[model samples]
Target chain A: MRLIGKEEIENIAIGAALLGTGGGGDPYIGKLMAIQAVEENGPIRLLSLDEVPDDALIVPSAMMGAPTVMVEKIPSGHEALAAFKSLKDFLGQEIYATMPIEAGGVNSLLPLALAAQIGLPVIDADGMGRAFPELQMVTFYLEGASATPMVLSDEKGNSLLLNTIDSVWAERIARSVTVEMGGSVMNAIYPMEGHFVKKASIKNILTLEEEIGRTVREAMKQNINPIEDVLELVGGTALFEGKVTDINRRTEGGFAKGTATIDGLNKNKGSDCRLHFQNEHLLCEVDGKVRCVTPDLIAVVDSETGMPITTEGLRYGARCTVIGIPCDEKWRTEKGIATAGPRYFGYDTDFTPIEQLNAKAGITK
Target chain B: MRLIGKEEIENIAIGAALLGTGGGGDPYIGKLMAIQAVEENGPIRLLSLDEVPDDALIVPSAMMGAPTVMVEKIPSGHEALAAFKSLKDFLGQEIYATMPIEAGGVNSLLPLALAAQIGLPVIDADGMGRAFPELQMVTFYLEGASATPMVLSDEKGNSLLLNTIDSVWAERIARSVTVEMGGSVMNAIYPMEGHFVKKASIKNILTLEEEIGRTVREAMKQNINPIEDVLELVGGTALFEGKVTDINRRTEGGFAKGTATIDGLNKNKGSDCRLHFQNEHLLCEVDGKVRCVTPDLIAVVDSETGMPITTEGLRYGARCTVIGIPCDEKWRTEKGIATAGPRYFGYDTDFTPIEQLNAKAGITK
Candidate 1:
């Protein structure tokens, strides 16, 4: 186990935003919340997957709702504590630790803040190595971990404990309820034993986020571009370098759904890339050719600073570099593809690995 | 306590439909479900408010969704049992008896059916003596009874336990979740102790329903018109005798919302009446003037047989009689009016007692 202090939170926030793939929520708010929590409660303890016992119960905590709504209605911190306590009370078991359901801006750091405040260790793992919009788009879900008994607590002291038949139903009901509960709520979900955690979770996600954050920060300090290091760290391909030309966004059904159009620069000058997203970037196309799709991670970072930009942060005329990382092997399975593949999101394209698409296009570093 | 048999089930269904105020659900379905349960489980024991101990827990069970949806998707008896059992498990206390949250076609009978299945007693009390649309539109809410910790269960083995700061939030969240759960789900809501039940509930609502049912049945058997007797029984007014000329309805936001226009017949031949509803009839206007408004109950029944017709059952060219009943004294309070009056339902008229409106129009038995 290692201690997650202010520096780790800062780095994790930056890395989480990078992996968040233009969704999750703003890292700035999560960063401030985590910093304040650490200042008041000291460093948070983070346990690796192997450190937890097989019988120990682990619950992942995060915020669920449209990132746009989250921007206006920041959580009051009490919500997370209430959700965890409610779930713990319902299970009648002591939670060994808390973790992130997905690695995203607010989601990844919220657990650290919660762990610090409640004096519990955070598992250095997450259900998704990168953010996905729906609840079932997690590696744990692909590995058959139940997404309930999940507790959702709003800022106004209302809470719901949902026990659904499947993760899909959980997503449907919880998403609608989230929209009703002022468009956002804190969730304590996917309670699993440590053994299941080891089996289902994407291990060392927090550590990876920290490493990405540190890489970006250090590279910036030395006045060098960090895009190559960031891409290499995630085993990702620099898909396109561009200036954002247009964006179409709408907050619907508790999700920030939209697309960003990027005008390619330098090597990709003739090709314009379109990034489609429902909260997180789900698809990427270069000049009308599929480059990357969901079950793959797509991130947009400042070309110079290499700091990640969320979907909400995308602006006209902003110079950015887009990267695509292969998802965890679990998501490549047939069931995972069926669960969150292009078809599920109403895309016409079939599942194809990002590297294969890049190789076909003869685009290499 | 009294034993409720199949005969009582039949009678309660008729009365529940009447008190449902042209909303709730169809009585025929609830009648069949309750009768079947009685055949299998013998009889359901119904306890009076006086019989319940002060500390005894009393949960009210009902179905939430548009009546139109309920007509198509009948709940399997398992949903109510699941909801009650889930709530019982959550509270960790043996629920003494179950009651109805509102007196409606399906809601009033659902508790009886559940009681029989679980071998739990039924309480003769209900939160609303007559049904209203929203969850918070109950006398219990005015008395400050919480609408949760409540459980909602769908036929597909999914359940949610909600705890809200107030009844309004409970209605908001539960309504959205109900829509997500296939537009209709069984709810175990407004859990209260016996003392609070007595204080908050409209007492002996089931008993009154049975009496209304018996009066109508006996009158029908003797070939006497049941309209006058029904009105006298409930201290209600015969507001209009008419034929349904038009109905404008759309099921939206988990509610059957619309208005029915009736062309007056007999003494009211020259006038036209408009009946407005959101699940339950909230307003009635005769010749473009407000006649009866909610928290008062407005019900439409067959002019020949006096059988109540649900909002969904309202049809064009059907000869009908519209009656208005004075609400419980508790509902005449300021808080009650603000919670469920005509204004609350978006009608411009102020809440006037049905008796006052009847006197003003010179409509008397």
Candidate 2:
């Protein structure tokens, strides 16, 4: 992977927005943050995880805490860099590079900012292929990776270093510090060598995110349909386009988890679709059939502007198009379903692929 | 803390089940597993973090994956032992003792089983006072603990040692392996020094769980209500009593997340209660006010049996009593709220403690 230019960042944001599947949070802020970082610090090196030397100490950087809070509490832009720098001092070692743990919304663009400012390259991969709510929900923790020696930096410039005995503790302690700091904080964690990254990371995800994000931008700039452009980039299928009719959401389970009922419009009318989101859309049900389930992206985009809206941003009157995109093959196996399927989210349903569901619904056209 | 007797182990399961508040899964199986291990290997010594020698190697052990799956897939009884032994061998050190990562359901008693089986002492403390879904959601993970170099073993005796770059990968890679191994696996992680445990652990949790679990058992044996017994054990408050009238569940985020609507009965009726759960009860709304919220334990128990049923186990027509207990003081901070409040979960309302809500609703009696 190489450095992406200014135009490419905008394209990547657009593509990442579509891939965000309507839950990575507002991309505009992330785009602005990334663009600012690039402008101020110069182009960041986007390194492939494979290209990094084995001895290179890599740290994943991003924001943590409630995304809803992120919208309200704009980052100070110093938290991520501060966290990374503090860890370097604490560990008494020069840092090698950085990467996004997941390529979604602010997090996707966050590392770009951090790496640009710190003069390191963002890796072309992430721990998770898509977005998730919790820090420990990443593939790394399940494989027994560390979230620790983690530093959470609040906007107030207060930094807390945690060396918990487990990942849950990291979340537990970080949550308190984050809330105390105002519900949003920047974090530098999952510090590991290239060997571990190669063993566990979903390779080239940053590149994939960049490709997907870029495709959306280029398509729109050229007067092309974003959904169609996105499909070509990832071989994704446009599942449905609808108007948000009703959203019955309740902040439950320490997450913004609820169901949004959408009126099928513009070819999806006469049919109803339901989106189940917990900070992100986990399940998209259409016409009484399971359409798109998690681990796969379920981004909701503005039908015209092609901008993305997060699950938190979902409203009753929002006109949107629901797109179902296939995740990497790693997310399709039985293990994928176990980690990202509808059942994994609590629905007692069989693991059905988006491709199969589209075929069943005749929506694959 | 020393080894709890076989009698205490039995009692602890009962109390732990009650404290589980209807979502930690069957302690029956965990108890049986612990009992069998204790019977087979005699007894385990219990140790306080303070008692652990500075050089002693301590590894926290628990089941990592879905509780719903754990109920379905009976562990082959050797997974934890395998993970522990693997980890023990990896560092080439004798593990001085074992500890529970969290104190709920099967995971609570898991380390007890391992400790007794290996003749290692059980630590009285745990990472979290209650159960959470993710592996990296622990206080230890926040405090620079490593979940990596973890060994995940399947029943087929296929073991993979993972050294991910971060905690998220641990969750990711382990969840994938678990999905392949059948959605449930035992993991021994966060191998740390005794000094780390002292700083990170909520000490005497097994003792706490046992006392709590035992209180429920003894009260029931004496024909006393388990809820009342629980209240006494932890200075808890009874939030509500009712019969489940509806359950809306969907598994979308690799977690069995949903809501259970309970009809107020017994002491109160003609009112509605909604308890939202994602692995654990995140919110408890009685009538229209928020009665109990996350970070604080909002558990449900059977009205008659007092046995706690998991969120997935809830069904219409089942009678339940809602209990609200305080969480660790650290969770009471603003940061804690950001990590685990109704707002954290996506609700717009502020948190109101169960006691205050109970007082408001005249349920204080």
iRMSD per prediction, in order: 0.5, 15.0
Residues A1-365, model 1: lDDT tens digits: 89999999899999999999988888998898899999999999989999999999999998988766777887777888888889998999999999998888899988888888888999999988888888888888888888999999999999999999999999999999998899899999999999999999999999999999999999989999998988889999988898999999997755678999999886653469999998889999988888899889999999889999999899999999889999998888999899888899888888998888888888764
Q: State the TM-score of candidate 2 restricted to chain B.
A: 0.90
Q: What is the lDDT of residue B287 in candidate 2?
A: 78
**C-alpha lDDT (0 to 100) for residue A139 of candidate 2:** 68
The TM-scores, one per candidate, come to 0.95, 0.51
TM-score of chain B of 1: 0.95
C-alpha lDDT of all candidate models, in order: 0.88, 0.74
- Residues A1-365 of candidate 2 have per-residue lDDT tens digits of 67766777776676666566666666777888888988998888888777888888889987887777887877766777678877786567888888888767788888887787778887888877778766776767656687887877776555655555566656655665565566788989888888888777878776776676666666667877666666676676666677898888887756777888888776543378888888788888878778888877787877776666778778888888877777776666665566566776787777677788778876655
